[model samples]
Target chain A: SQQGEEDPQALSIQEGENATMNCSYKTSINNLQWYRQNSGRGLVHLILIRSNEREKHSGRLRVTLDTSKKSSSLLITASRAADTASYFCATAAATDSWGKLQFGAGTQVVVTP
Target chain B: EPEVTQTPSHQVTQMGQEVILRCVPISNHLYFYWYRQILGQKVEFLVSFYNNEISEKSEIFDDQFSVERPDGSNFTLKIRSTKLEDSAMYFCASKWETQYFGPGTRLLVL
Candidate 1:
């Protein structure tokens, strides 16, 4: 399977703290994306990091990709209670032009105020 | 911002029945996809559509499943015969560069 595996199945953190999660995949990928899903809601695209790039940042979210290791990490700095959700890493295969995303079992995050 | 849209946010169906889930992708976006997540599980890719045809599909997209872009704007997934295992949150996504997903349709097959 091309699925990615996420570390730390769940995390509970206080507001204003940082929350970091890691993802590892077994296949070659063109890019990796992070998404947030609220309980029983739609997935919201958070950020995307191309395999050629090492790190990228958007707002309070930072994403890093290491193709050699086939791994990626997402860091939410100064997390807020509203930032509580499941974080998933999805990868677009290097060979698929259509960009089908293989998702990982997500990390459920809870931020307490 | 443009986003994908799906109809019938929730559906409860009996086993062996056929159900069609609908999605309207963001206009001007050419790629469309269907994915599903069972309760407490990771999301699984179902099928991908591009240029009015299937671009790629996962093994999970078997004979029981079919996808169509009937009009220029709507993409649909038809399950020939629903099974209890088909209960999941079905999500539709579209992309020009980065994919944007629709509010999913929660399906419960009894």
Candidate 2:
């Protein structure tokens, strides 16, 4: 089964608008993490929400996790052109090695000025 | 702040040749991981290392692949014989609580 699957494969928004992307997973997880990648670059760790936590915030990023539903969402508030990048949700399974992450098909966000 | 780092930003090798990708994880990090992304696909986990041994590996990691932490800070992935399908960006990561990824090494196997 796919571990992480995100909704809305692509998104385009104007500056100052909000961008929300949803993700679902198939198994129990210790933590869910969000990552950002610019074109042709490595992924940058954004935020991590543990199964015990419902929601988390960091700067302009807000992440919510619903373990009961096996789902998570990432909301980028006040989007900016610089926010154009691919966002991915990765899960660290409770049964697996702690750092092994299974990533989802990312949300391609295009924040136009 | 400190971060993971990798060598050979890009590598082009012929199929069947051996290629070794190197990474220097965060000095204090104890867990290290290797992942790869084929151009348009999701990032896939290849293997994880801790205490100088492999903790776990994915199916994608076969006999053709091997990993080592020969020294204290250097971790490496060696593909015994490259294949066309091996072309992708290989990323090395280190874990504290949050994983820190290094700028990936893009490999092109022709």
Candidate 3:
């Protein structure tokens, strides 16, 4: 499995500040996706960036993928206390025709009021 | 909004016992997958089922593991002879293109 490795295992930010987390994979990917898990609950899909796309935004979330570097970044702007959660990056490896994903260890974000 | 649903948020079983996890995928979704996450670990894929059969499975999905779509809506994962290491969070996901995950079943094999 081509699991992505996330940097800065934990992050802390004040409300209204921006939060960014980076993920790196060792293999080529068909697409990269970001998911958020509140506590031990299920994962919520945030965004997906294809190998060809550079950047994408959904509401206050921005995802940037760099295929050449095999890395991606997730940015959350104007963070709120409710946004505190563990964010994971998953990669759909190009060699995996079934589209099975490999997930990262996740970044724990703490948003304080 | 349609989403995947799972039953029995938690399950506790003795070692060597059998356990089955159930999931109901979105009506329109075509692909169903199973993943497991141990506490403090990343989620790992177990298997992917489509067209009423298994399309792919990982090394971790061995003879002890099996999956089935017994009905049009329900998908199941059965673990034979659960081990202590099998204690983890199990998630079921459905995908048309992007996947939607169901709340996981926390399995505790003692």
Task: Give every candidate's TM-score on chain A.
Answer: 0.98, 0.97, 0.98
Q: Model 1: how far is A14 from its true place, Å? A: 0.3
Docking class of 3: high
lDDT by residue (A12-95, candidate 1, tens digit) is: 999999999999999999899999999999999999898899999999999999999999999999999999999999999998
TM-score of each: 0.98, 0.98, 0.98
Q: For each candidate in turn, give its C-alpha RMSD to the true structure in angstroms.
A: 0.9, 0.8, 0.9
Lowest lDDT sum, 10 consecutive residues, model 2 chain A, at A92-101
Score candidate 2 by lDDT.
0.95
lDDT of each: 0.95, 0.95, 0.94
Write the residue-wise lDDT of candidate 3 on B47-80 in tens digits.
Answer: 9998999999989999999999998999999999
The regions of model 2 sitting more than 4 angstroms off are none
What local lDDT does model 2 show for residue B37? Answer: 98
Instruction: Determine which window of 10 residues in candidate 1 chain A has minimal summed lDDT.
Output: A1-10
TM-score of chain A, cand. 2? 0.97
Residues A19-105, model 2: lDDT tens digits: 999999999998999999999998999999999999999999999999999999999999999999999999998887656999999
How does residue B89 of candidate 2 score in lDDT?
Answer: 100
Pairs of residues clashing in candidate 1:
none
Q: After superposition, how far is residue A36 of candidate 1 from its true place, in Å?
A: 0.4
TM-score of structure candidate 1:
0.98
Ranking by lDDT: 1, 2, 3
